[model samples]
Target: MKIDTTHLLSAIEDYIAKADEDLRDTLENEGFVAASETVRHIGEIEDALEDVLDEDALEFLERVKEAEGVDEFLSVSWPDIKNEGDLEKALYEIFRQKFDEMFRSFTFSWILAEEPEIVEDISGEAIDTITKPAEAFIKGWSGELSRIMNLNTKDSMEKMLLKAQKKSWTIDELAEAIGDSGIRNHGYRSRRVALTETLRVQSYAQQESMIQNPLAYSKRWKHIMSDNPRENHIAMDGQEVFKREMFELTGRNGETYLVLCPRDTSLPAEETVNCHCIMETVENENALGMTADEKKELREKYIAEVNEEYEAWEQKFKNDMGIEEPRDDPSVTWEIYNSYYEAYRKGEIA
Candidate 1:
């Protein structure tokens, strides 16, 4: 039996787009809170630095004053001033705490609510399979956030110190530089982390739903184009593979690796960050446990009912909007289509 997937794909895409917007708004607010906390924590670290200026710390500063460049300055360690270690520990804790808060506020229940309509056939036992990947993603993402934050803290500290030495800054000036770094550097990183994680969760939940559906036979990867896209990901666009198989990609270091899905959490940030790819399922009618005639009757009934409902809605939309000139369709203009589609999805239109 041939199943037309135009409506299915379109519905899923529309649902995902709305979910992405909602997730982005929620996560962006959380990111603002995290960024503010990061700045406050950095201020406390700077205060600790001022309080620890004993003789040995002063000597370390003098050496830093005489140093030629960042490399030379870093070679002379301040054994007495323990703020660097303390700052590392503080940032690491902040990341872990913030990530946990974000995860707690997120919910996966909406994913399952839409599964029966979208996936068509999934037992209660199979529905539970969707959560396993989501749980694994959360664990992996939390660890990755801690690792990135720690590395960023170390790198920013080095840059702040080097800038101070080059400009002959006083202690207060150096502290101000560090404070500026905290505010300027972390704001974007917070937003980026929020966007990446939100998209990853949505993708994982949908893909797992497809995997559990009895009619789903295989999946295909479709890459989205954007400015400064990754060459490797672009190459993988439109590649069809079985649901259980992996997509092989070569890393920048020329090492071959495999990923089960586009935003696989086990992979590094380079491969997954800001990725806009999607996975679509290829369905098989034979797997539905129906005879040929029964399958044909079911398909026809489903398509006819959906088409009738959609056609009436489309005519009403065109008349209400007063579009006199004939175009290919109302969806030819994306802005108009999106507004009406979103309204319909929200049940604003009868």
Candidate 2:
């Protein structure tokens, strides 16, 4: 099935604008950082979705049309419903059921609500809310989907990774395994590219975390500190601990190390905004032959590369937009990446 990305992008932009307004009002009135952050995160997710939709405009349109049809069906007249309340409830139930089915069929994942005003109702005000963020979300999600599709374009390579991980086959693999699958592209280049990008993000997050919590570094990495462990020993082992813990948690088999944000502490509200702990894998670390200093140097070198790439991308975006002076907002970038990652995990973006 095909999908249209434009409609989805428009819907997401609207949703994000509304969400930002709501979050600002909340933050200004009561200093509700958590709630405000949630809204901001949603906005980022919307932005990510927009990026995806822009990549494959046609397919996005098709999916939106299908979803709209489902919504229309739920709204259409039913022969047996007589009460308004019953009708509303019935429509909600039907929409939820149908939406779930559609998402499963398409291997898409995202949150949907019976009422767009649900958040406002919860917030106890007539806050601006997107009644149907999905319309826009799908559009924004398409870009990521296209990237994922491109990554999973090879049959043998797809199977190799899945087999290595010992996980059940995914939609990408299923489509490839079956000869009649609609998808065409599937290869290692895509997988490697995706993995590398993810690693870069992880490294960025780690550095941001460290910069935000300098004190935490001493407490967590005491071994590296000037004080001896038996004397004035601090827990200056956070970065190393974080690296080990994250590697184990991701099941990368110690291949990947947490490059950024090695300690777990509440950062300043601004710094912690949309922070997602990510880890990077060192090739030599996997070989178990590299010393700690070697690994650290390699990670630092990789971080430099990530920063250079980021600067290039930022410059390109500014050039494309014809903006002589771009706003320095890490929060915005964080939100965008976080949103895309959330959509991917949720299957909202293939």
Query: In lDDT terms, which candidate is top?
Result: 1
Q: Which stretches of candidate 1 lie over 4 Å from their true place?
A: 1-134, 162-168, 182-185, 251-254, 266-268, 290-350
TM-score of 1: 0.49
| Alpha carbon lDDT at 319, candidate 2 | 71
RMSD in angstroms, candidate 2?
A: 22.2
Clashes of each: 0, 44
Q: What would the TM-scores of all predictions be?
A: 0.49, 0.23
Model 1, span 1-350: residue lDDT tens:
99999999999889955755664454334222232333333334333323322222344445545556444455555322324444434444444454333332222232233223442363463333323223334444444444555456456556677676677766656645544555233544554655565456545554544444445567778777667788888888777766545666665556665666677654678887877676666777665665545543443454355446545655665677887675633123333433443554455754
Top TM-score hit:
1
Q: How many collisions between residues are there in candidate 2?
A: 44
lDDT per residue as tens, model 2, 81-143: 112232223322332333222322221101111111112222321121211122122222233
Which residue pairs collide, candidate 1?
Answer: none
Per-model C-alpha RMSD: 23.0, 22.2
After TM-score superposition, what is the CA distance of residue 346 in candidate 1 from its true location, in Å? 46
